[model samples]
Target chain A: MRRHTFTRFAEALPAAVLAACSGPQSPLDAGSDEAAGIAILSWVMFAAAGLILVAVLALAAAAARAPAEQPRWATREGWVVAAGLVFPIVMLSALLAWGLSITGGGGGASSPPAAFRIAVAGEQWWWRVTYLGPDGSALFSTANELRLPIGQRVEVDLTSADVIHSFWVPGLAGKLDMIPGHVNTLPLVAGRAGTWRGQCAEYCGGAHALMAFTVTALPAPDFERWMAAQAAPAAEPDNAEGRRGRALFLASGCGACHAVRGTPASGTIGPDLTHVGGRPTIGAGLLPTQRGTLAAWIVDPGHLKPEVRMPPFPVFRGEDLRALAAWLESLR
Target chain B: MRRTLVILGLLVALGAVGALLFAWSGLYNVAASVPHWPPTRWLIEFGLENSVETHARGIEVPPLDDPALVHAGLGHYEGACQPCHGAPGQPPNPLVRRMLPEPPYLPGQELRWSPAQLFWIVRHGLKYTGMPAWVAEHRDDEIWAMVAALLRLPELDDAGYRRLLASGARMPAGESARLLAAVGPAGEALVACARCHGLTGAGGGAGAFPALAGQSREYLMASLKAYALGTRASGFMQPVAGALDDEQMGRLADHYAAMPTPPVRPAPNAATERGRAIAERGLPERGIPACVTCHGGNALARNRLFPRLDGQHAFYLAQQLRLFAVGTRGGTAFAELMQATTHGLDEAEIRAVAAYYAARGRPR
Candidate 1:
């Protein structure tokens, strides 16, 4: 019975370890050139440490089993100097130099200059991402989700609206602190077109654990199309229910804190909803983007994400809430 | 000692049983015509006085010297108070005197209690007494106005009382209904409203009642329903609205909605410019939305549910905003949106916004 349990545990352990080491948010499962270098460095250090451990164990076993009278060379201080001092110094210096070369101070070690700039401000519990124009003026802003073209080096200017927050996407580059009143640039290059997860690495106040986002590396043409669509006004509702929802949204003063392009909702207190429907998730990636989730969020955001700033709207009822969610979903 | 203790215990038990039997034998008279025993009356009065003093202790009094406030209070007093608590030289109705613990006459009664005690008694009426609490508990501003007028009651004779109400464009309750009879059945229902809000629905000039004229029928109807349902907090409007049936409420809403907006005199104070800026641009950094977006500042078609604020009284607007800021001004479902938008505004900003709207003319 004990052997059977042990066998089962052994079988499950590797699978779990492998699974944990290869997610969209795992540094070992690299998707960018910079992250690949980090993965390689991690593996090299692991292998070197394992080898040293084995050598030490073997030497200790041999010493313990052997006679009390040891050889002159084994007992000499010169052996200690060669084994501990010289070996460690050379090995550490090599590792440090290699590491510095791979992860250049700004990362994107071998990539060309960044093609475009993206500014991401860490809010209380959400990421406010803005796509900047050539002259560095803000083109448009979105929240929670970020997208850039694959194979292009993108310079991301990270800052905070309130407190210090660390922006980290394990599959991309490395963690960087987003400090208030100061901007830190993180250069990232995505080698493959795929989605990656990013999280707040530092402890912010309430709802900090839920402050997460996503990075989608799109193809060049698709990325351009998305940018243009996001820049334009929201698409007009195609149905009567959608129109009613739009009227309610404006009349209920949702426009007071949120801006929908091409509408009277020019307020910038909350996230922009121009392309919110197209996003994969909402509420700082806390929920999947769907009609049901959107309606749930609108009616009771604090219920799902504690200490969230958005107030619940008890006013939206069955049909009204459904229509509003459906209309927002249709904005894509 | 044991024998003596037994006797005393038996005697106490016998006394308790005798008292219970005397009380339960339908012997105590609860009729209003029957006066209470002197000791019982003293005990009840003692409890009432202590309770009021304890509760009214922490209530901070606002400055009540404003004549406009006194004027507004007089208007309400004539409608809701005068019949029960008579003005100077005019005795209360003879029939009111027949009730047990009759309501007091008000000419010189203000001298007995401090303003805070008066406010407390008016806000939360004495239990088992004929006095009733204010219709809306959240409307402290209106209650303070009553206190302001109550403070002046001792100095006003019958002529002074009538003249003060007249200067505020208010009349007695019966006179209001008789004169508004030409407005049809809806006007008849608005007698109480007309006492404070004028005949054409123009508010008291210094901002007593809200201007209801030219408001959308939908908005007015919703507000009336909210007041009756106790969802909207207003001591003045709730009782008046609660007394009406749905049909009467509809008629009244239609009547008020159709009344032409009276010409407004622009009262541009120093804050008007700042108020105009906030109404138009808003302090976006603080997440305060421009007031005009929801309250109407453009020619664009807006939802009728949003009330017209173009010619609303500055005092009324400022009071409502203060209520919203403190999270007490309950209104229609849309009011929650204003709670969030106005949560961060300072008092100065609120007054400025009100002044801007008050000085604004009806949009063309």
Candidate 2:
């Protein structure tokens, strides 16, 4: 029975591994033009590697089957010239040129002009994404999430607020470093409208492993609508509980580090919360955005994301905490 | 050779048994009157001094020359230390001299030990002796203040001592009669508190004390209970509050809470603009909350447990904030929030915020 189970597991393992290569976060999934080019380059390299493996295996097989003496064609000198010396140089040089053509065409500082630019500042363990207008003025800012218009090349001006962090969206483009005091640009052109997961590729301080974001590529009209909505002030809470929560939030020190535009709570230390209710995740994608998750986050942010700068509000309890979280969720 | 070795081992075992029996017999002198032999006394003294020196090695002493700090230390010394360790000219009571390990007179102590060593000894008192560890274990600031006074003792004559203590108000005579005449029935049990806080709770002795008048009843009660439980680190208030029963604590809280607030001190110079900014808006970039959100007079914050900061002494507020930064200022359960909030503030910001609050009068 155990042998049968092992046989089944071995058969399924290859399929599972292949499946893993095509997910929301997989480079091979290739949601953007840049990523598709990378995918083709990757496949070509893999094919070359497979051909080399087959040739080496065939030579070994022939050597094992042949008599003690080998033929002149299979001698050390002949193999060295064909496989060892000539093969690597030719294969590597080809792969390098191909890889460069794919990455360099749309990558680096001197790439073609983008339709619009966005500024992404890497904080300790979070991303502060600011959407810029055509004139380079900031339209609105959000945290840990990016919204892009599909089929249009959007340039991302990346820099670090504190330390070095690498911005990586595997399905969109290659990773780029966000170095402190230096701006590095990454051009992204989404070929399809979908959500792709991104993560901090570099090891920042504590909570870096939890620092993740999502890029939503939308149709131009939808993207425009999202920007307009995000730029507007937070809506007034309609319910009594939400109104109470707003009062409690200002009364408690939530306004000190987080800002909700067009309110007395205009703090710039932490993320903007004008459209927090529309977000799919909070705490920089540490938890799914919901009332329960939001409440847990507010009461104990460090518990959810270690070394978080936001202090815990253990004083909020039961109905008060619930009301506060609901009000925040209603901010959209 | 084997027989001889066996005999030697037996002899060693026998000696061990004999020593055990001797200890069990209880024939040795154990009375306080019967002083230790010279060797035993030397060994204990050696161990005590060495232990203090070892533990006190890394303690960094702050500047102790401030006149206000020395003055405040003198205030605590008069009530807490003088009774046991005796001042320069005043000898301890005749009965106190009879204790097993007698407390030493504190004058000229700097000649014998460094300020750090004295701090360690005072903070963690002699274990076997009658000397008790400080009531508030987390309050190193208060203990350091005491050390500053101890360092000054060798030079202070009795006249100087009296002069330094002149600012500390004396308790009124006839407890009930005076208490009734002062702040009414609530003041009846506040004789010890009034020594520094004054009868009406208008804090006295420059900025050394914090004014308690016009504070909320809930805050006052919580503070008193915290001190009694030793959660709040104040060596001065711990023992006083610990001695009071629940009812007495309630009355004391009520007494101070109902007392009318004193007139606001004149605002400091325009240099406090930085402080005003911090108090109103906070250093948001550093993740520090605005002091006005909860403690401001204009905030009208609903959390009654958070004490009113307006008109409080700037020096006292600044010192408390410094203590909070180091996680040494233990207070009510909500105080942890202050610890988190103040963690990012620099020294200049702390001073500025304190000054802003101290000059602002009366919580609305």
Candidate 3:
């Protein structure tokens, strides 16, 4: 197959390229625009790197074959000036502008349609996600990970209580800060349906590095179903284990720090346990949200975050712990 | 060349002999009475502190939020900590003072610790310190609640403390009271603690629970967080504070801080007065840090991992000296740096130290 005129084919293209060119492309061939961009950028970067390497090899060959000369700092400076200063500044500015064209920030302008508002408050080592979406019909609240439809635009409001913090997702866009005293907004447009990793970029304190979450972009219907489930009021525990856990949680002052939309555990000092069972990890994604790990965290809280505000539950051992853990897990 | 070599050899031999003689002669007092020489003291302190700080830099900590974790911590505190540390308005047993480093007034946490620093100290108990590492094998959530409890403890009064302490103090207090507040608690934790910590912020102090009123907000706030997260190592508070949130902590801190700083009695002797001057004023001319720099940075923020010296138990401060020397009593990351300032002091100094701090005129 013939390559495009723009293709500086120093060598023949691959068999995959030959196959790809054999038929008219399908409508879904390239996936989303972001995926397309990623593919193109990867090729461009590889080509540029190959060309540079070849040029360097040629120069090295010439030098080896030719006579040696006294080293001059002037030549070094000129080369560095062109490659480091002139070339980088030009290339980076163009790339930055191009990136903005893809995801608007710093003069690039586009706002997420204010469909729903979620206020994310950063705590000692976890995230408290509160949905201010329309009451029962459109509301959604979850922790650690944030979910949205693949094609829809979402705005995240960020802020912290103790120190400076940042929000970042490697696959989507750049990092942004969640400073104290004021709120900041960032728009996210995920182009494909996949679970993208999100992490807290700023070092707020002792456990800064472990902070992580996911940006799950789902098909529209799945996303809607998730939202609806989230908005629905939390389940009232009736099963033996769950009833016991809820009672234990409240009796132990869990109500003092947390809130369950439908329950009497109405303290707002911590996360809303109204739907804790749905979360994959506890303690802001620090530990896996399994019964045993949950039990351990419930009992101590010290090993995980030293000097942490949460105290240990020494009194509950054996079945008391099991019943309480079972109850919290039932809050789904 | 021979002369040079001879001189070098003699110097080495003389140094070795000098060291041997010193060791054999019992010239250097290992007793707490005599302080280590300044240079040696600095080396030891630097090594210990630098090691801990450097090591702690890598551990990952997540943001704190766990309702269940906090709940469990509360129950743990009621059973384990109230006996020694006391609750809001509840004072610790006077006998605890007889043990080195008397248990601090639990509710007045502002003078206790910084959140992160507390975690580190808790994980690694100090040497020669009475403060024990947490009993729970994996103590993440419990620590956070203890922090929450510490924040809340300061505001609770005797009635409140008892209510929180009891395993069955529910709001409605009867069958068919199925408000979310009356959610099922199958085990010991199925009970409410607000009865003791108080619906309002007032906690116990005059009774079994130490009165949290007028204690350091900073200490109370940070210590609560530390205790919950197990950063502030304790038999109980770690679990209790672990169960709360920033709002509860704020509420607790505010409630207790608003209470009056307990009135101060005059020191029993002039020595205590002198100690007070040392703590408040410091030996600035002698390159000593003001005890208040860390302690009194902010009465509310005293929990920056520094226990409040003002109105603390004198005997407690003295025992803390031995712990601080060994690197145990839970402290902030910079706690070891605190040692250099103390290495120069004798046991007499340690006793005078607490007297001065404990004698601070009153909580403000």
Shift in Å, residue A175, candidate 3: 2.0
Error of 3 at B351 (Å): 26
Q: Candidate 2: misplaced stretches above 4 Å?
A: A1-17, A64-66, A76-79, A107-113, B1-29, B33-60, B87-91, B107-111, B157-159, B166-189, B202-206, B259-281, B348-364
Which sections of candidate 3 miss by over 4 Å? Answer: A1-43, A57-61, A68-114, A134-141, A305-308, B1-364
Best by TM-score: 2
- What's the TM-score of candidate 3 when only chain A is evaluated? 0.74
Could you give candidate 3's per-residue lDDT for residues B155-236 as a string of tens digits? 6677775555552223343432332233233112212233333322233321222234455576567666766666545554
Note the residue pairs that clash in candidate 2.
none
Candidate 3 chain A weakest lDDT stretch, 10 residues: A21-30
lDDT (tens digit, per residue) of candidate 3 on A184-209: 98666667886666678888888777
Give the winner by DockQ: 2 or 3: 2
Q: Largest DockQ belongs to which candidate? A: 2
Quote the lDDT for B240 in model 3: 53
lDDT of 1 at A296: 96
**What would the per-residue lDDT of candidate 2 be over residues B8-82, giving only the tens digit for each residue?**
999999999999999899988788888889999899999988998999999999888766677678878887888
First chain TM-score for all predictions? 0.89, 0.91, 0.74
What would the TM-score be for candidate 3 when compared with the true structure? 0.44
What lDDT does each candidate get? 0.83, 0.81, 0.59
Query: Cα RMSD (Å) between model 1 and the true structure?
Result: 4.9
lDDT of 3: 0.59
